[model samples]
Target: MPLRFPIRPEGLTSGPTLRPSGGPNGAPTYEMWKRRIGASLARRDEWKESVIRFFVELRGERVITWGAEEMQQYFDFWVNILYSNAKILLGHIYFQDPKLIVKKTTDRVIELAPMIEALAQYYQRELKIKRTNQKALINGIITNLGVTKTGYKAIFGEPIEAVDERDEDSIAVTERSLRQMGLLKDEKKGVLDPEKYHELIADERPFVINVSPFDMLFPVGSKEMDELQWVGQEITTFLSTVKNNPLYPKELTENLQGTHIVEMPEGRRMLGIDRDAFAGDEEYKIIRIYEIYDMKNNQFHIIEPTVRDFLHSSANPYEVLDGHPYDFFQPCISPGKDVYGTPLPKIDEAVRLEYVTIRQRIMAHIDKFVARLAVRSDGLDEATLRQAKQGDLGSIIITTDDPNKVFSGMPNPGIDPATFIHLNQLLNDLRISTGISEAKRSGEGRRKTKGEAVLIEKGSDVALSVDQDKVDDFVTGQARRLVQVILRFVDYPIALMFADPGQAEQERAVIPSEDIRAEVHFSVKVGSSQQPNPELDRILKTDLFSLAINPATREALGFQGKAPDYVRMFEDVVAAHNLPNPEDYLVDLPPPEQELEEGEEGGQEPANILQALAGGQQ
Candidate 1:
């Protein structure tokens, strides 16, 4: 009675026919014998060897794609037979579902990320989710959330009833998550808006930075450069045009010729030089002027701003370039501006290697500097850096987080809560009541104890033009708030003068305790080879992975070969009830979701079309 799909209809007979023996069509006895032999094999060993496979991806044990779970499981089992541990190493790549809208796809994936994360951990060591993954996750959640809703509740029941529904609220989280997945194309606004900040996440590989070596050295100066800064700004614009920004042109010129850039009223004195020009100098008077830029030893090929400036106009830059293109002009490790507009010296191979070596030393020290900031000593667990406020300086970390939502977010500029109103009332009273106020003879407070120092309302003092009356009013008002006290006589006591003052405020500098450490990783070049330097390569493969670094260490040693295009600051995590930095308060409204359109077109109701179709059918 066992069922098999591939069997022919005629062969399922009581006794299979070899050729219908004795019937109009064939010989029954021989047919029966051969059919019995065929059926008796059950299945050939070779047939059993080739097994069919099925896989299952369950969301809380509810199948997202119907029958996919069984297929996945079967495939995993068969694959294992051919190769051991195949399931444990598999990774999945999700794409946008052909049937789902881009918005819906994003919403679904974010919802399912936690679920997918658990599954990835169970089946494989790695996990990933593409924008496309959203659709699949959404579909899975829809399928799972529906069927297992009751079961999941029962399993996680009783004392958990008070939990709030975080997932259902904040529908804008879908759009934010989509953007993180690299799918949303809304170009009008920057992505940092807090309503858009509620959702985000990722996975990664590799580490590198642009800190170049010492041979391609640039001189350091304390003063900030004006022209250099401007040139840097222009160069940054130029680099933006070059997709990945590939050059590092330091302001290096071997033999320099600099024409002074004009600034108004030249500090160096010239008896009668033209407005735009200055002749020589008594220049040793220290006018704070400086040449803030210089080139790496042999890095530039100083040529005319035009083609005529080259040493040999017709020669190739490579043949005339001293070293290979990559080394002659290695990408700049540190950002700089050309201090002198003159042609730079061409660098050779020897210099490039040395440059890499010394730059590595500078980078190494930076690592030590960052380590100094992280608080680690003895066996005490590391605590969050609780920075203390100092002087007029406040302790606030720059963040993208929504302030209104924060526990200590600044008081709302829009609404005055009761505490703030009460504080404001107290402050106004202090501002008006200075010393004594007898003028306030009919207000809420007017009485004072017998020897209380009170400033009475007196008319303006002549000649001096001082508002003695107003001053008296303020002073007398203040006396009502103060306790009456007698002071020992002074040489020139102007009848009951008040003198005790409040304590002076202490002051301090800001050196705050930072939870995050600045870090640097060393990168060295072995001459000009395409191969990774053996020392650096070894560090990446061995040191980076094996080292059990804390979060601060990971942040510090982010990369040495490259810098980040977008650095997500730890302080930037935030959320809001509405899109954009709300000009007013955030009202907790329902999230943005697409609702059922009731037979719509372009998301509007489509009643006419339905009516027309019905009429046509009739």
Candidate 2:
């Protein structure tokens, strides 16, 4: 029988209902609506499990049920295999050098990366209580690129406008604090309340919390026409408190009338009482809170099934950083239906399978080593024959004097070296097929010239560039979405602390996220300064130097007849080469001393440096 919803008042059925309350004759029941969503999620989760089974190995209970039993044994080995490339690909493509560029009027407004860095630090500081941002980001990126999908939800406190407003209680406390601090000497004497003091003095700046992929689920099979303005995701998390939990929210334990209970309404109503099941001597059981996203209307229903007042938050404050929070960053999209972009591990599954097969074959070679024994028991006692046949006891004495007839070495087929060659070939194919063969084998190959090596590396990245571009698009979208959230939610001016672009000291710039006049936007630029094109720089430098040395080419190119102009031209070359300050390296020599004495006004501008050099050569 289908699980039923709890009894609720008829009045509660006017809005969205938890049960199939009275409605139009043809209206689908609440249970039916849930089933539709559940069915789609179940179908999508099957695909997720298939990918996870073959490639992705997650800790704890998997989100989806395993399809095949045989693959479970391979999880450990495949995790190792999958992680090696996943780590490299995620690192090389995006995190190797992540740059955030904010634009205003087609010009970079300020250093956006520092703001992101600060946000990342804030996330670590607030949520983790200790620093583990890198670990968190690494896991998130790997899951995004190699598993099913990835999402980042930014959790913010109440907007400044909301938090700054003080009620009558706050005003009275502030007045008391003023008197306690001796600022109001003539006012009525009163002691300051510690709770109020702490509340008033606490930092209330907006911050972020990073959500792991494993903790979240969204509509992977959603269509474009769904017009889903908000995410329809389900996030599961813990709400821990002490025994009888005075610290836990009272609203959490008080049973609410119209809420889904542990997915069904049959469970206990009181959350606190239900949690007694997890209660031990003194430890409190953590209550599981399910934050389900309602698709039609962009909001979350915070459901704590056991709680009497199951309502946590009808509307979620946090928003997904990427527009399509459900879709994942897929590096290598397979040829099949792109409902969910195929994970990198799935794309390389065939190669990985071959690798395992070869490994098993090599291990099976041990079975070929066989031994043979021939016994001539013409006069041997039954005990001796039995002992020889048993192959037990250290020494078996032959009844007859001829022992060579009883014991002999058997013909053994030794392992072939060709098997090792085949193993190596398989590994090579695995690496090449996945597009990391050159990068992984950089140390093993014959030494290549710098140019050749660069070309090789560039070519190797070509295979990954497609996936890299996809990641870039996702990241860019995330940046844009984050900005939108900040603008819509944050009313206070935020001080973005950043490293000074010109100096070593730290600097700060304030951004007002709620400003209507603000026309700022941002895009994430990855692998620009981090992965420099040295070959391009070298070529440009050589070409410019060649142009500088040849006076004929300079004249034909409409050269401004001055050495200082040539200096400016060289500066352009250096700038294009992405070097900082050409003046530091390229010092201008005093104009031949004679030109300095003659005051460099006439005399053909002291023959220009290149012209003088060319004249001497002539």
Candidate 3:
């Protein structure tokens, strides 16, 4: 059933109510919005609790309790298997450099492809996107859902020099220019060097914030991200940071009250911390801020629910031409039709509980059957029995004349082999359920040839392709949103540094806002950034060498009587070997002189293909 809140008339009421009525004149008050947010959070409590429990399992916490008399040893299969699998996926997903393919949608903007690609690559490095991607993927794998919020953020510092408004001839710096420069302070008064300004605040750029699943809230009936009417995030921050921020009005910040025990709506509880630690520390008092993105009303708001006040409220400030600034990643789709459907975590609590139960029982059984000595009461005294129980290597035991009648070793209570068989089957079931095979994890397979290894690797890749494709789609969506932000806000001609083809050193070019104005499509070259498979590289090298040696094959492939393109072949070989910058190792050769007629004077025979291949003098 859908969780719904009651709708009240637009007027202040005196009695307690489930829903909030607006203030005077029908303007929505902060309290009104707070009720709405509270309802949304209450609806998502179950899923949020599950996410927290999954995190506990990932950390190998004690989820299953035991009695005082029971053995309490936990074998952490959750972290042992799930974390290792997550790392394996991360290695394959981000080992190679990502290649962002930007193409012009129309012929008129065809020249902008290189500039767009360079800008995208610059953002990729400046934003540390690969790190963000790794973090998000790991979170998604562990918790079933990962989210990222992308938008342009500009931070402004105090003005260096205020120019007179009447000075038209003077180089008057506008607010926009100051924001573009992102200047912190003026080292020298009245001097503005673009290079120095850029160096001053190089860290200020667009942001991609990773939002945890616990802090996110959406409606119960929405099936997809875009279909949601609103989304809210519960943020925990210090009181001083909120007061110092420029976006919030001073009226709201000054009147705010700080509290040390603010209840987080995300079901997060603070435990084992002394409240006296924050007794007199008002500057660092922790607080909760609720940020809501209301798509239905096209409004954005930041509220302090503890004090029942709105910090900042305005129309949506972002130019969401592609979509909202949020991107979601799920390893696999949920089985139900609603957004609240439960996604399968990499490892759940039930499986871990079952494994631990069986293993602990086996250990307890073994404990009951430890080696013992069967000595007759008449055969030995108490002291002798104690000595025998010690089972010392070189100790004498006083006994009667008939030593054989005195003592006998207890028969061994051998464990049932089926117990081990059951354990093995459980492990096998786990591997199959997670789709992480033993060979894939341990890299141990009974293969006699490199070809078989390559085939196995290929099969593993195919098995993981479904999850990989989902991550790729999420990344592509983020790239599109990032491009939109760049086009809208990058109004100044910023200097971009990139490597030019056939050049030994890097080059710099200034891209004006006009250059970035183009309709471009964004895509990620899937698997291009993945780690190189050595077996696959060996196969590729074999094929390239065969093509180079077989003259008939070369002729049939239109190489005719000329040597193949050695430069391209060299680059491929370098890439196969996982070497960087193949261009640096290549030498430019002059074009072959046109063949002269029989009577012409300056004519030379073509170099032999074999001699060229061997780099030998003819």
lDDT of each: 0.24, 0.45, 0.60
TM-score of each: 0.12, 0.51, 0.63
* lDDT tens readout by residue for model 3, 1-618: 121223334354221123323754344567778887787678667665665455455444344343322322332233344565676554454634467887657764566667777778778787888778776766677656678888766554644333432333223223333433233234463435433233212223678878766678775445656456567788888888888886666777876667765333332235544445445565657778988776545556888876646687655444244224677787756544456555555344466567767877776765675544443556776777677666542223333566665444433246687877888777666655665555665665335466776776776667677776787787877787777666655555555556454554334555556644436677777445434466566566657866876877677766455666767877787776678998989766545557678887862343787655444345
lDDT of model 1 at residue 568? 24
Model 2 lDDT per residue over 1-618, tens place: 112233346565322233333324433334433544465457556755765654434322233343346455443334344354555554454353345565544223343444544553443334441222233334433443222222222222332223235565555543443332222223232322432332242322333234544444334333221233234344433333322333235655533223222331235444443443433422222344544544333334544445543243333333323323333344444533323445555555576667777676655654443333344556666886677656543223343466554443433246577877887887777677766645434433222355664565566567667656666665554444445444444444555545455754334555544343244454555543124555555665657776776868666666555442566777777776678988887855534433344545543443466767443222
Order candidates by TM-score, high to low: 3, 2, 1
| Candidate numbers sorted by lDDT from highest down | 3, 2, 1
| TM-score: the better of candidates 2 and 3 | 3
Which candidate should be chosen as best, given lDDT against the real structure?
Answer: 3
Tens digits of per-residue lDDT for model 1 on 152-200?
A: 0001112212113334333344343333322343446453343333332
Better of 1 and 3 by lDDT: 3
Candidate 3 local Cα displacement, residue 563, angstroms? 8.8
